[model samples]
Target: MQVIATAGHVDHGKSSLVTALTGMQPDRWEEERRRGLTIDLGFAWTTLPGGRTVAVVDVPGHERFVGNMLAGVGSVPAALVVVAADDGWSAQTAEHVAVLDALGVRDALLVVTKSDLADPAPVLADVRARLAETSLGDVPGVAASSRTGDGVPAVAAALEELLAGLPAPDTTAPVRLWVDRTFTIRGAGTVVTGTLAAGTVRTGDRLALAGRDVVVRGLQSLGQPVEAARATARVALNLRGVAVEDISRGDALLTPDAFRSTGELDVVLVHPAQRLPAELVVHVGSATVAARVRPLDDATVRLRLGGPLPLRVGDRLLLRDPGTRTVHGADVADVDPPELRRRGAARVRAADLTAGWDADADLARRQVVLRSEFVAMGWPVPSGATEVGRWLLAPGLADELAARVPAVVARYRQLRPLEPGPPTAVLRSALELPDAELVAGLVRPPLALRDGRVVATDSGLPEPVQRAVTGVLARLAVEPFAAPDTEALAAAGLGPRELAAAVRDGQLVRIADGVVLAPGVEDRARRALAAVPQPFTLSQARQAWGTSRRVAVPLAEWLDARGVTERLPDATRRLR
Candidate 1:
């Protein structure tokens, strides 16, 4: 499906032309029909000769309602520029052409109406010459008379040929449907109509409207009920969770999270003759808001919007001075722009925008950037770009992290030698790195990961602590399970700190609190318990170990916990 809006001066027979082609009245209100002028937007659709359906949005061409006109055509991809044979070109016609040019609308059809009343050759020649200078240059033109229906078939044929060349809408892109009309039906609840510019909308899909989610209870394309609707079609959505009063003409139904609303933008102006005024009315999509402009250079400026708009890069906005009635065009360069803090910051930013993304330069300015955002801006990652998960960092940043790890681990060991080295999470926080993968990649060579902690490969106990560990192990070897208590171990300089270090180094195994054993003692105990009967008593197990109850009891319980034995109801133990 295709949508084409009418652009011309008032009383130029735009509505009449639509009514003649589609056989349906474009005027909806009684006041508009009585006044013989289209005060608000009107809609009508027709089947072309090639069986292709096209919808027409008839916009009021008066100067006072240019805002309404912009709302109707801001999202429409193609248009039919209407001019009258008798009037030739007028002020509103020129304004409309300027708006289309500002919107970057290149696909159009020039329709000269009232051809039966006046010879359209001169008017067609004049309109063609004028449009040749603007963005709608060298477009196809047709002479039609809506009253007598002469040459109307030629207009239809021209539209069919134009629609043939139009590209299919991108369904993969995010949906941004600008609401041009909203109302309530008797059984359908709230119905909002607009051109589905991109993406697809289905019956159960949820969309964001005015920061709130609303379910699509139903959908219609060109007045036919449908379960889903695709782009470039005139869509009427039956919204479930909103009221008629909650939505207005300018509110948009967008794919949630895919778009962001902002009140500020960085843009590249189109043929900016002079510095823009301090205040201007900016039109984007279907919404218009007053904004303040700050010039960055001859062709760049920063605009602060009066309200938030879901804008994206490459979107063309029409800037109009409400006071002076001047129109200018601009293309959005950046949505989330950086703040200019110091003097000459704007110039530097302008240079960045103009130079595009240079990995070296951007890394020097912005140390890190989210990989998703970087790619969305159409930047190519330089060769050897350092990426840590979703974060893209500078090469220098990785080198810096690698360089800081050793010192960090050394300080942590000096502070707490008994404990394992600093945890991966702690190291990440201390270095202010954003990702754990970055820390993991940086811990290399002389650094290694032990358990969950990062440590130097040579990290160990001091000379005195090492001697104490060796002495403690020798004593445990004599009586493996009959290990020394906390007091006896502390007396031998193997205190809690030294014991913990030994356990971490695999020199000792801690069976229970204050109970340390040599590494091979648990295996010997398991072997001894296996030789007993199927179910044996605790006294028998203690006798087998040849130790006192204090040491024997904990060791037996530790074996039970390790699944080597199970305690019976009568206080006997059995091998599993």
Candidate 2:
């Protein structure tokens, strides 16, 4: 697991404890060493008694640099919450605890350092009282003084127990890593270091670095290369092509299909101080995004953002207000973003926390339909749990519906094989589905859509009509050499409507009034009209064909539609 920095007030000896334990000075920069305060996140590692090694992130303790502290603690799961043995619970301490709680840090080991410098009794009491208000209050605190190494081993032991007991962060969950640090090296491309917030990262995986595809050329933990990493592991990834100038302190590295970039989101903003957000800045993990708050309740609010960001439907992120022009606000919970909203307001109530998945079958079905629409259009899925719990389509039934719909329609058509098929009500009666349901699901084109009446794409003409159309076209291929006649269609044993339906099915084409043709009839009609050798008058035309105008009109029109003969204004037909 990846380790992150501790939280507490200044001079709490977080750095001192880290130095005494890991024997590596956490103050890296020259100014920080002289100032004797950890102005940034300090990184170090130590081996526990259980033979498992762990990494530690020492966050800044000063209130002024809380944004940096949040950045340090963003990706870590279990934290080492430090408090001075003498000063007890300070203001920064409370804020740090709040940050930890908001970030959803589940497992943490408490450490009350500087036991020798001050009386431990009253301070420990205050510490416990302070812990009572947060998720980590139940966690045991180890008292230690970095100077004499007193209780250092005890603290290490407690940490080992905490590590062993630490709940394994869900690797199967969608991945989100907040980029805390971005730098470049001589040989490698841009290397971004951060904690793996959730899910797993493997070699050759393509991740959306700050919502853009960034190649993972390599991964490192505690300054050494590794193949794969899981949640809560502090890692430095050698990116393939992106540059350092493109990214900075507060960008997130996300799994492409696993997460979505959203400008609008639903959030539960908590101003533990009860201070409302006027125009506060939101910090999630290491990256801070600017957003405007629309509060629903004391604990819940909606954060509308200023830029595009990758946030999964169920994932959590921290929020903050920029204390300084270059800083962030206090942390808040990412309760899931509001539904896509444009030019309108949505109300999120207190019950919204347990309410996102509050969907029934009908609602879930709608959600699934909407989700399917999204998927078909190539959009991100909300979540499977959300789908199962609150989607408009429930129980993976949409997929089942997608498969069942086509099959049911296909089978229905098979059993009723007839010309023009059945009407909407008839097919729906056969399927026993509502009109709306059938229309939305099965009857919508290109699968099934109604033009004049309902028609399934898979529906075909009746067998006899198909055979009749075939024989008519075959006969016309020899003598008439034109399209089949509508009046003579009875010659092939089918009615005009059935013949028309066959023409619609591509068996024939209706060229003009009372005239129809099979495929390639136009070319044959031209040859026949040419062989007639002369423009015959009405009588000669009728006599030559051994038929009256009733048969001749339809036949002549068939030839006319095929451009074989032009009927003159004086009733004399001519070869064209």
Estimated TM-score per prediction? 0.90, 0.68
Clashing pairs in 1: none
Model 2 bad stretches (over 4 Å): 269-275, 321-500, 503-576
Worst 10 residues of 2 by lDDT: 326-335
Top TM-score model:
1
lDDT of 1: 0.85
Q: Write the per-residue lDDT of candidate 1 for residues 432-531, one digit (tens) a residue.
A: 8776656776787778987988976776777788888788788777767677888888887887778888898787898888888889886788788778
Please tell me which predicted candidate would have the highest lDDT against the true structure. Answer: 1
Native-to-model Cα distance after best TM-score fit, residue 566 in candidate 1, in Å = 4.5
TM-score of predicted model 1? Answer: 0.90
Per-residue lDDT tens digits for candidate 2, residues 359-458, read: 2422343444444333322234544423422123445554554455555556656775544444556555655543434434444454655553455676
TM-score of 2: 0.68
The local distance difference test score of each candidate is 0.85, 0.67
